[model samples]
Target: MAESTTIEYLCKFCRAVVEVFGPQYLRSPNAEDTTRILAQNEAREFYGMLGSIDCLHWAWKNCPFAWQGMYKGAKGGCSVCSNVFAKLVEGHAPPVNFKVNGRQYNKGYYLADGIYPRWSTFVKTISNPVPGGKNSYFAKCQEACRKDVEQAFGVLKSLFAVVRQGPLAAVDHQVPVAWAAFLNMRQEIRDPQVHQELQKDLVEHLWRLKGNA
Candidate 1:
């Protein structure tokens, strides 16, 4: 089957799977279940968080340059990127409002970089000169937290290899939507415990690299 056809087939399969197995198969037992598991595992294992939020860019095969402006990267490129906002909750599952209309919510009072707006729910790093002219701790913390979102994108791209390469056909926005749904569904099927562990490892690894640099 063509790539597009394959995606359509998988989407149908996912809908059928969810119907047969139930939505519980794609989520935690309940919000409380999320809170407890996240709190226990993330605090003990990861040290800093339960998750992070960031954005990912995918080429829009036939999107107009005008609309593409809305999809540009923070560095000023006309690329199609999806804003993904996430966070880790200790003894708690992550937020229930994960994605809204394919755009991740920019909530929480955590750290982020300049690219994101400084909402009451988020803590963005500010560049301020110190009396002694040393690097700002606030800046460092922001960079660290921001990395979580970046790493999340990396993992998603790696797992869903299709995303790493190519322009999604403009004919079907549903294709990408289904693809994201599949990714989320796959994460659920693999178990939250395992997903939490993977996140913990990735955060630690990224932190180490940031430290070295």
Candidate 2:
């Protein structure tokens, strides 16, 4: 016989669905546990820097023009997308609440392209650069931080192949936000460590590529 979807099963399914497609999805599946772990890890790796920020576009099956203004592509495409801004911090060691050591970040800042706002929390890349001066400490750090956001989006797209395909079936405009939340939850549960490692490795790899190019 086919299995029944009972309330207990439904609850679990809803939780999973929310965990996969709701706002605050990242905080759903044992968020306390994952956040603690991630905060600790980020502390060790980033010397207290939080996470990265970037924009992503998701197709809106029936989106209106007003919403489209916020969904511009990196190369000026008119696709419907959501601009996600995230912070990745180091994982603090055990028993300390795993809260980010924000003091270390007082002097440090996050890197972004021209899209993000100029907040005290984030640092934007140089809109224009002097010739032969692209290789500087500040430039390198900015490049490193910006790459984290790109890699985070990359991993998200890779795992949730549906996101890579096209517009979602849902009619609600908030569906993309829900999808982002779900992806965040999955990241929290399954491969937090993998992302941390990838972030670290990508910085070195990109630097090498820049040098070669």
Candidate 3:
């Protein structure tokens, strides 16, 4: 009965997520209209950046010991970690006509940590710094911005205790359902004016800091 109930609960929540956010949030954006203006503001030349990508571990208490080898990470716990992006778009696809440095590109990029592979679409943080200069400055800004992924996930785990505690058993579809819930909860501002104002403030602050450094 307990197993059955858990399965049913997962099914119900999963359905609720799809019904609530599918049409508007999960579907891919129209290729032509999705611009990279905000991302460009974050970094001078990094246009068309989708968001930050990273992995986080969630404790899995009910895992079988036999399976621990595969599920356990270096942290020495039975946990499930997901490689997820801070931003979500419909169809998990990026818009075409993506350009960077005056070169036309086919896909958008995600900022990630160094552990992730070096790919055209993944921007990894610099491991070593060379005193105070643009390279170090860029690394600082990149890391600060990439933290959005961790902070966003932190909010989700806070709101949904079930996620923080981990499900009794993992379901493949639960990840997307959780992402849907997170997107709704994050309450992103759609007003261009609000974003513009915030961006202006951020740019000024960062430039000021650079001058001081």
Best by TM-score: 3
- Cα TM-score of candidate 1: 0.44
Give one digit per residue, the lDDT tens place, for model 2 in 82-103.
3222322212111222212222
What is the per-residue lDDT of model 3 for residues 1-213, given as tens digits with 9 covering 90 to 100? 699999999999877776676555444343433564335533643455556644356787888989998886544777765433333322233343443333454445566666554445456666686757555666677687778666877888888764577443322222344656566423332333433333333334444556786
| lDDT agreement with native, every candidate | 0.45, 0.45, 0.54
The deviation in Å at residue 148 for candidate 1 is: 4.2
The candidate with the higher lDDT, 2 or 3, is 3
Give candidate 3's whole-model lDDT: 0.54
C-alpha TM-scores of all predictions:
0.44, 0.42, 0.51
Tell me how far candidate 1 lies from the true structure as C-alpha RMSD in angstroms: 13.2
| RMSD list, candidates in order | 13.2, 12.3, 11.6
Tens digits of per-residue lDDT for model 1, 115-202: 6553333334556636332235435554665685578668877876445653222221123335565565444433535333333334
- Residue 78 in candidate 2, Cα distance off native in Å: 6.0
Stretches of model 1 off by over 4 angstroms after superposition: 1-11, 17-30, 33-50, 55-61, 75-107, 128-135, 161-213
